[model samples]
Target: METFTEASWYEKKENSIVKCTLCPHNCIIKPGKTGICLVRRNIEGILYAENYAVLSALHFDPVEKKPLYHFYPGQGVLSIGTFGCNLKCSFCQNSDISQNGIRDPERKALTDPQEIINEALDIKGNIGIAYTYNEPVIWFEYVRDVAKVAEKAGLKNVMVSNGFINETPGREMIEFTDAFNIDLKGFTEDFYKKHTSSSLEPVKETIKTIHKAGKHLEITNLVIPTLNDDPVVFEKMVEWIALETGENTVLHLSRYYPHFKVSLPPTEVKKLSGFYKIAKKYLKYVYLGNVADPAMGNNTLCPVCNSEVIVRNGYKTWTSGLDQQGKCKNCGLKIIEHI
Candidate 1:
């Protein structure tokens, strides 16, 4: 059966063609040609999204697995993902699902919003549904619908994305989402084009939109060795986050292993530490992942009092220094707004 797409965010290119203005790519897809996302297809003068209602993977996962630290720590989130991506990240960890056009059989059955909510309720310490594994922005309609259902049920909606969405779609979905973890990728446009086949400006815009919406926002910068591990470039990226986003934003400096087609080598611990120190100058919360360090970069500290606020023992979040209202108990300073 062929899937028909309902596209509202597009421009008529010609009598029998249209252009998808969904992301920065602005793909002018001819009839039967799918966009770079492999989901949005132009079919005889109408643009359609193939992955709508076509769910590929769903599971209950650790919120820390989302790498979302401050928002409902150590809880379970009903993770969800469709297929296709806006970015062609060479080192994509989820490429088997994100980059491929074919569907896998080992996945779960497709359920509606109610089933998703029921599953979230059934899980122990579970928060809500997450639009992840693939680009959630492409599934904007489904996410918005499910998020509405989830929100009414008093469940949170979270998104794990590459942050390569346009302003219109980003703003519409963010109103219903509680928190987000955006992959910053790299600091320069060249790296974005070379590696991800996308641009960096829209992602920066999306990050800013999340911050302005009063939604909890976290950033992940996967440090690829040599390619984007330059100290000067890393320092600039940190400064941008500090100045544009704010000091309180949580930045996860993830270690990169050789994956996908970009086998540049794994990131060094010394370089990760060096970037951490440089990032600390402009940001308050910075944590390292995917590498074994001295546990220095693993735990969260009180920015104001210089005391350990949350002692995280590799996914075991011990909230000792945080009061009921998420304030630093030592100096009574507000560390995280929505802790």
Candidate 2:
């Protein structure tokens, strides 16, 4: 039988209704009903995390694949993800796992937190663990337990999330997390409401909290062709990021493709280029993804000398122009977060 662990960040209400405090949703779940995340359920009067120790996918991937360019440039991270997500995104690339409330027979596996930490130690060149693929925030209990153990063992912890988590849990998790790649879906609240079924404010809050906590932070904006490709809106988003997060914040403008629900044509390279140009206006570091533009976007250049500090081809990374201290070898400017 699948063990159901009582969840944290929830308050019992009248007649067995429980309010989930993990995210901005604050889903008031009744007895036998699950939260919007589909992973946290109210059994009688207690909130239980349904996906505890349940893994849908696990792999040793380049840290760069987390799209975290500024943190440990060429290191490997053992990425793990489980079922369910807090938000309902129409263009969700991993909806099969993210939306699967119950464990799928072929994809589900059960492993204890210590086992996961051991797997991280076994992988060659692995710097640590990355809670990724599906929304890691939905698998909060498992992630929190594994992260605590991983940190004690001196392994770094990274979170690749949509940044919808609430303040209390987010702060607690950030205490153990070393870095994050937050998905800033779009600029407008309407964009978030219409597409992701979540709000924009909470995500911004999550980003600010992580940044203020002194963790290495990166942001990714998936550019959907007609939905969120407006130049004015895109520029405003980049400007806000630069002002609020810092000019040095690493941002990735990713091309969108037809996925789970949205069937619009793939985002154009020209749109990405335009957004990239706008971002470069205020941000010190920005990159393009999904579409190939090797000379223009994939490689990282020093802000001071314009020398290629890190060369990236797909998941491959070469840190040739970065010194041991992670400074620009040519101009001696400190560019990345050095481990």
Candidate models: Cα lDDT each: 0.84, 0.88
Q: What are the per-residue Cα lDDT tens digits for candidate 2 across 286-317? A: 99988865556989999888999999988888
lDDT of 1 by residue, 1-339 (tens): 244447767887776778888888888888888888887878887887667657777788878888998887767788988888888999998898889863843232543677778877888877889999888887776788789999999899999988887788778878889999999999999999999999999999999889988899999999998778888988998898988889889999999998889878788888888999999999989999997643769777888778888877776777788898888889998776665
- Give lDDT: candidate 2, residue 159: 96
Best by TM-score: 2
The per-prediction tally of clashing pairs is 0, 0
**Which ranges in model 1 have alpha carbons more than 4 Å from their true place?**
2-5, 104-108
User: How many Å off is the CA of 161 in candidate 1?
Assistant: 1.3
Q: What TM-score does model 1 achieve against the real structure?
A: 0.94
Q: Candidate 1: lDDT of 98?
A: 88
How many Å off is the CA of 205 in candidate 2?
A: 1.1
